[model samples]
Structure formats: structure tokens, C-alpha cells
Target: MALWGGRFSETPADAVFALSRSVHFDWRLAPYDLRSSLAHLAVLQSSGLLEDSVAEPIRGALNELISEVAAGRFVANETDEDVHSALERGLTEKLGAIGGSLRAGRSRNDQVATDLRLYAIDHMIEVAQQILALQSALIAKASEYGDAPAPGFTHLQHAQPVLFGHEIAKHVQGFSRDLDRIHDWLDRALVSPLGSGALAGSSLPLSPEVTAKNLGFTSSAANSIDGVSDRDFVAEALFTLSMVGIHLSRIGEEWCIWATTEFGWAKVADAYSTGSSIMPQKKNPDMAELARGKAGRLVGNLTGVLTMLKGLPFAYNRDLQEDKEPLFDSIDTVLLVLPAVTGMVATTDFDREKMALAAPLGFSLATEIADYLVQAKVPFAHAHEAAGKCVAMCEASGRQLHQLTDEEFASIHPSLKGDVRDVLTVHGALESRTTVGGTSPSSFKQQIKESTAITAAYSKEFTDKAKAFSEMMGA
Candidate 1:
């Protein structure tokens, strides 16, 4: 049954019904809608808008409907217009006239806004937890390969030696910030829009606080118009998830490069690698490739929803329906990518010797030489020039920096007269970075310790919130 029809003499055209149908994608909001209905029923009864006799059976039916929906026994039919319509149709079928009274002070506008927040907040917490799981995998792998030296790049060319573990830990830092963004997004998302009927709130004495607490919102919306129209939470969620996708893409890009035959610095497990359609020798990094490609898709989803929102006036609009598919797709994409990429990182093996061999190439140790000269009291400008000269000389002779003889080093500068070759090895270069957050073994180990603590703390916070949500929902 249509929600509004008494004013219209004729039924809506088939094309109009088909074009406006949302149950196809929005049936996923069924459980949240049902739970919100239970909360609404409580308010209706408390405010005397609904008698206990009416509210009691409606409550029982709503709960039963939730179970049926969960069990896949009750679902949206071709006649159903949207999740709200489909659910109201189910309720009316059960209680006759009484089921229809639950709509007393609510509108589809506020109901949908509330449903989306409930749905998004639930999934965002899950996504944040999945991110922490990925962080855990990286921490484990970093600990496994402590102080294993690798070439660090600037402009994709070798610039310095870094511990392989340090490179892995850098992704964790980006993901940690993503978690912070999710936490901040929750601050705004935790408000209820249920009582903000249509645009202006109802004149009825409905207790919004009761419904808000029942549905796990920290408070009800203060302004009815903003309550119904605001979708900043959705946009922020997209931005946060897109950041996650971008960070995942970075990992994908680096892993794809490292797995190449020419680089061979890392190897993907057979389970994670894919065979080429035509080339028999291929074990392609398709997982990483897809991860890299999905970043664009997530960004596109964010952009589309924001554009849809930008032109609309305050209060609810049909354009707002455009928000769900993109938000849902982004959440689904991140949930899918996180586990696959985490497995790829956790199971893959690294070739420490291969990475080490490339560590000192492109004169990556030139900075080490420059720093060595500065320690001997040479002016930094002169030291930088001397280091540049050494690189130029090595280029002319087609020799590596370590191959330079002591007499040659002495001829270049007075500070190079002694055991200047001492700082030339890859191990020496890695160890020289002894500062906090540096590539030294001590710093790398300390990083692992801190990340482990950080992951544990975030994991705890999510766990606590989940418990609070369960208690609030009476689950």
C-alpha cells in the first residue's frame, strides 16, 4: 500500500512507482528500520498518542517482523515501494488499523534520515575494526622483519637506506589517522533525527529523548530542518573511507612494484597471486592491482554524492535518496578490500637480500657521506657540494661509492682522509639513523611496541562502543 493516497483520486502511474522504488537497494536497512519502529512505538505510547493496547501488539509484531526479516522469510515484494513502505505494509497486515497509528508524529523524511544514520554508524564501526585488523597484520609483519634493510625512494628513485619494517609501519600511521576520522565522524552521527517530522517537528508531546536513547543516539536533533536535510555524516564517511582506499592503493602500488621480476624484492603467496589468462608464466598481483584501482571508485562515489547534495535547498529532497548507493558501495568496497589486502601482506614473503642489494644504488648513501663531513666541522654548504662532486666523480668512473679508494677520498676533501669508508655499508647507513621514528633497529622495535599498544587501545574503544550499542538497542 502507498503511504499517501487519500488526497489522490487515482493510483500512481507504474512508471512513477518504478522510478521511485528504493526497496531494491534499501532493504538492507530493514533491521534498522524495524528497530527504529520499536523505539517510535515507545514514544507513541508514552505520549498518550497510542494506547498500551495498541502499542503492545505493534511492538510484538515489530519484533517478530525483525526476526522474520533476519531469517529471510519476510522480504520486500515487487509491490513494495521502499523499505519504509514495505515495513509499514507488513505491520498493517498484522494489526489492521493499529499498525497505521505508529505514523502519528513521524514522516518518511525523519524515518529515513534516522535509518541511514543507524545503518551508517553500525557499518562505520565495523569498517574501523577491519582497519585495525589490517594494522595488526602490518605490525606483525614489521616485527617479523626487524631492521631488514631496503632502499627508500624519493621520486621513485633510490634516495636512502631504510629498514623494510619501517616502510611497512608507515602505512599504519595513515590508517591510524583514518581511525581518528571515523571517531570524529561518530560525534555528529550519534544524533537522532527521528522526531524531526518532515521539516518542522511535530506539535504532539512525543518524547524524542526516549526514542533517541532507545535507538542508541546520544541526543535528538535540535533544529528540525537541519535534522532532516543534513548529510555531512555521509560525506565525511565517504571522505574517510576514501582516505583508507588511497592508503590501501599505496600499499598495492608498492607491492605490485616489489613483486616484479626485475625487482623481486617481495613475493605474493600462490593463493593471493593469479595466473594470467594467456601467459603460462604469469602469477599476477591481481589483488593488489584491484586494490590500486578501487581508490578511484571510492573517490568517484564520494564525489557523486557530494554533487548530488550541493544543489539541494535545506529540508528533505528526493535527491537525498542518491546518497545511499554510494555510501553503501564504499562501505562494501572497503570491507572487501581490507581482508584480502591484509592476507596478501601477512602471507607474502620478502627477499631481504634483494632489497639490501638495491639499498646503496643511485648513491643512496650520499647523505651519509655529507653528514659524516659535517661531523668533522666542515661547513654544510661545502659538504653538500663535496658530496655532489663525489656523485659526479662516481658517475664519470662508473663505480659505486664504496669502490672509491682512501687516496681518492682524501683528494676530494680533508675530512675524507681517515676511515671514511666506515659509513659506506648498507648496515652502517641503516644504523646511523638513530633518532626517534628513524630506520635504526632500536627505533623500528620501539615503533612496533607503540603500534601494538595503539592497535590494542583502538580495538578496546571499538569493543566498548559495540557493547554500549548492544545495550542501548536491547540486543
Candidate 2:
């Protein structure tokens, strides 16, 4: 019989019970369940509703359960519908009815909410750590190659020359912003929901504050009706995961394009690539492809969770159970995807020679040409027109502007100097862009240092969060 079978005269049919079962999908949440229950029980004792005689044995049983599971000695029976029942079954088998006394004033409504928060907070630490690793990989790679010249793009067409490392660091900066969002989302996951029994506040005089403190929550909800029914935290988690996937997907897509023989901009390490059976020389970026595809899946899962919570009424509803699977799935996907992409990045090779050769083409220095005229006291619009004519003359003659003779350059614009060719040189073009965030070697070095420090600070913050969780879990 199910733990809640006392009100029913007969058991549910196989299909019915099977349909209602979540143990198959949610068994991974066992650690989270035990963590939340320990805090809840601690609060129960603090509130004077439970004596030490009962709470102590329950605490011992819970710890034993955690230890057994950690050592791979625990298993769930077919009859268990969820982690809650699996845990109660395990405790009863070992501690008898005394183990059952822990459920006196709570309902699965609040119990599941507690589990969700625990799961998010726990996984947030993991995801943040993974993000930091990827950032470090990118930073190391940047330090190695940030000064190598590459072309900047506009509408996917080369528009200007930039340092390759600076381009990669731009993406890392986006990730830094995203990691901040994940931390902000952590706030939602750190609110205790244990004492909000079912939909209403428990009448057991439960100490929500004690539970929150034990669980590492900043505080508990004041309105019980809002507490258990709220899956806003799940939505925020999904939203955060969606943003994470978006960043990963964008970078993955670029990696796939770059690794192609056509682009020849980067080469994936053999350890992170796959070969085709039919094509003898086809080494494909399967990891990048999967990362891109998983981004879409995470987005879809986020939408699914949001849709499920869209119309649910207050307190607790059957719909709340729908929240668990998506949260677990999204967290699992990001956890798997983040580490794989990070590994790929750490091992990939950049084709600096290919990038520099391509960087000087596609009129990448045209802006420099216009700016040169502007610096020579030419009117801005007149400067733009003169540069356009210079490019047109070069194209007609099947030559680059830098290859033009001084006499030919003079025909396009009298302001053109004999030194214009040198001005159009790749090194000159890069060094000329002295703006703070531009792709100059000197400026790019500054960005690398600043971004590396940002990642370091984030690493420290993540370590602190994990340490707090560890202390709270007493692990």
C-alpha cells in the first residue's frame, strides 16, 4: 500500500499507480529530499512539537540513509512512488513506527517544495563551478592568443580586424553576465518552504526560521498559501538554464563553423571530435552539435515548466508534481553540457596563421582608411567617400588599397599619403585602434587581465556558496 493509502479502501490499479509514480524519474532527488527533511525535522523539534526521543532516532536514520545511498547501498522498491515513500519505507524497515512519527504534521505539498529548493541550490553550486571552469579555459586560451589578429564581422561579413583572443573574451564576458544571473536566481532557491504544510501554514507551530537556517535559506515565506504553491523558483531556474544554454549554443555554433575546413579557423582536438564512417577525413564537432541542440531542449523545458504553472490556483495542486521532472532534466542537461563544452574548449587549437591571412582581406581596413582621412582634417562624409573610391579603384584593378601606388591613391584622394600603404598594414591598422575596448594588442591585454580577475572573483563567490551549503548539510 502507498503511504497515503489510509483514506482509500482499495489500491490504485497498475496503470493508475504507474501514471502517478515519480520514483523512476525523481530518484536522483533523494539527496535533496533527505536534506530538506532533516531541516524540517530540526524545526519540528525546535517548535516543541517533537521530543528528542523521537527526533534523535529520526536524525540518525536520515543520516544512515544518506550514508547508505552515498555508498551505493540503497535501492527503491517498485511500490515506492517517490523519494518520500522510499525514505519512509527505508526508515520503517530499520526503525519501526518510530521512523513514521516524522510525518505527523507535514504534507507532500510542502515536502516536495522543500526538495525542489534543495535540488536547485545544490545544483546551482555545480553549474556555477562548471561555468567558472569554462571561463578559466577561455581565459587561459586568451592569454595564449588574445593578441593574434583576426577579422571582426558585421552581418557575418568581415568588417574590421580584431584580436582573436579579444573576440573569444567578448563571449566570455557574456558568460560572466550570465553567471551573475544564475547567482541571482539562487535567491529564489534559498527560501525555505518546509513549514508551509500542504497549502496553508501548519497548525503545529512549526519554526520556519529554524528550518530555513538549518537548510541555508535566507528566510521562509510569510504566506503559507503562496509558499507551497509557488514554483516561481523552478521557473527562475529554468530561465537561468535557458540563458546558460543560449550562451553555450551560440559559442557552440561558432565553434562548429570555425572547425570546418572552409573556415579553417580552429581545429578540435581528437579527444573531443568524431570521425565519419563513410568519409575518410571527416572529423566532426559532435560535442558542439550536441551543445547547440541541448540549448534548444533546455529552452523547451523552460517553456514546459512555465506553461505548467501558468494557471494553477493557490495552495497546492496536482499540477505541482509536474514541476519536478523539468527542473531535474534542465539541471542535468546543463550540468552535462557545460562540462563537455568546457573540455572541448580547453583542448581546441586556433589557426593563427589562417586568421591573420584572412584578417587583412574583405576591406577590413576600410574604416582605418576613412579615419585616416578624418585625422588629416578631411570632412567626415568626404573622408567616407574618398575611402569608398579608394576601395572601388582597388577592386577594379584587382588589388588591395595597400597595394595601390601613391599616384593611383592620389587620383582617389589628394589627401592620401605615400605612407597610406604602411598605414593599411595589419599591424598599423590594429595599433591605430587605441580605444579602450578595441582590438589593439595593448587594449586586448588589459581586457584579458580584467576578465581573468572577474572569473577569479566569481570562483571565490561560488566556493563560498558551496562552503555554506556544506556547513548547512554538515557534510
TM-score for all models, in order of appearance: 0.98, 0.95
lDDT of 1 by residue, 1-475 (tens): 8898889999889999889999999999999999899899888888888888888999999988988999998999999999999999899989898889889999999999999999899899999899999999999888777858889998999999999999999999999999999999999899999999999999999888878988989999999999999999999999999999999999999999999998998889998999977999999998999999999999999999999999798799999999999999999999999999999999989998888788889999998889899999999998998888889889999998878888788888878855777888888988888898999998888888898998999999998887777665555
lDDT of the candidates, in the order given: 0.91, 0.85
Clashing pairs in 1: none
What is candidate 1's TM-score against the reference? 0.98
Query: Residue 152's C-alpha lDDT in candidate 2?
Result: 83
* Cα shift from native, residue 199, model 1 (Å): 0.9
Error of 1 at 225 (Å): 0.4
RMSD after Cα superposition, model 1: 1.2
Worst 10 residues of 1 by lDDT: 466-475
Task: Residues 38-143, candidate 2: write the lDDT tens digits.
Answer: 8778877877778998899899999999998777798788989988899899889888988888886778888888887887888878898999999998888877
